[model samples]
Target: MVERSHKPGPISATTASSLPQAQVNVSDDNSKVTATIPSGDTVEVLLYGATIISWKSNGTENFWVSDAAKLDGSKPVRGGVPVVFPVFGPPPKNHATSSLPQHGFARNSRWEYLGKSTSESASDDSVKMDFGLYSAGLSEEAKKAWPYDFGLVYSVTLTKGELSTILTVRNEGKEGFDFNVLLHTYLRIKDISTTTISGLLGTSYVDKVLDARESTESNSDLRITGETDRVYKSLAQDTTTVVENGSPRFDVVRKNFRDTVIWNPWTEKAKGMGDFEPKTGWREMLCVEVGSVAEWVRVEEGESWEAGQTIKSLV
Candidate 1:
């Protein structure tokens, strides 16, 4: 029931040239672009959604993708860091994207590979690339759902011990538009029950699991038990930490993104997802997304907005 994008052939030398001296490899099916670092860290990106399908540190994968994930672009891959734009969950009441998909057309549409770059500084050596989608490249269905000229540029950077993503949106139309966006990150964990998220204390959030009720987080550390879906708004801090078994795992930092979405399908909801591996998949992954979703961003003509998130390992 999902729409698929056209698959390209393997990346050629000319395509690899965009990355300069970095080690760039294309997927066998030519749907992905992978950049590897000398320190054994690597990042794989799918052109379909500019999705970060994999990120490995010291040969250990930090991201999770469902075993039953549709890499052929049939639907948005069920894992990794998916770029959500224009709208977050459902469309705002009577909004332009009301007729579009749940997260809008950005994740579902194919993006054009812009280029890649490598930066060397005193402390870090990183490889980064840009993938873009414009109103002209959007599908007819998407154009009809929200007819406005727009441009989106997504940048993925991989450093020695960190992965960063920056998303910038430009309004090219004659009028302004309002929208929401997020980085729907599915982080891999050793065990979901043993995981605890901190730094959201006193932050007000919308509890999606309990009929979208609003509540304040009084607990210093939040643990998962059942199906959990909450959107923490107007964070007092810019960073949050994820710990497992009393050991810090990773730190998530956000810039210009005011909200954080925490989700876990748990048991019953996980059973209904066809793209997710049924039995044990939910136990291996948790979603701790960061973005500007609680409120809408209004962009006027020829204006732009940028938001970013960086994930660093604490181990």
Candidate 2:
């Protein structure tokens, strides 16, 4: 066995010789699984949508979940990390995803666990769990909405203070298809008003609240004072940070993702949604989502594409 270290995670997949044991807890009904690394970090994933509802690092929850989130598979979970595939937001009128729901069926559809792998190095012990969502496994209603053979492998890796999520999509059909994918990550914070985002100093973005007009960011450290929803593109750096109360809280770095979406519904907008409980939940969360959305990714027959994000805790 590779001896563990007290130092936090470094957030990269590794190949080790011996198979390290994964500390896991699975629900009796198979709805969720909670896996832990040897260094005391844990991650909880639900089978429905293969969504991660909880990721705890050093006993603190990094991802946020709404108090009114529906976990019974009756509807999509309101918060945390919800996988968006095949489409993002509303569908265009004359498109293959026209008949699909707002963010496609990936978040509402149930997924299957493909199992887990654990490895240990001198630095820490890491566990990577996989989930599968195949076209044949989707509901008939979803199939009829957008018919195309595909396979999605969602992997979650945990090592101390970092949680990395990766998705690999393969086209399993005879013909090529176009799709868009994203991970809607709701990062919990001490307070939204105190949170500031750096590294987007001069990036251009599409302000969705302002009728989706193209705009340029002028702030050196962006702060949210009102309802905000903007899609930032062509970022100067691949690594960005979330600073709360003048302290660096989280560092987010992505691979193969070309766009970053920053969002917070604030007061009036939060009150408008029925699922947004407490009416003040917006003050405790900030969404820094990364994905490929400026243009659709086309996967030819027998071809595959992949993208992912890694979050490091700075607390």
List all candidate RMSDs to the true structure: 12.2, 7.3
lDDT of candidate 2 vs native? 0.91
Off by over 4 Å in 2: 1-21
Which candidate leads the pack in lDDT? Answer: 2
48-166 per-residue lDDT for model 2 (tens digits): 99999999898899998998899989998988999999999998899999999998999999999998887777777899999999999999999999999999999999988999999
Give me the runs in candidate 1 sitting further than 4 Å from their true place.
Answer: 1-21, 121-123
Q: lDDT tens string, model 1, 68-180? A: 88877789989999889889987767777798889988887888888888875435668898899999999898999999999999999999889999999999999999999
TM-score of 1: 0.91
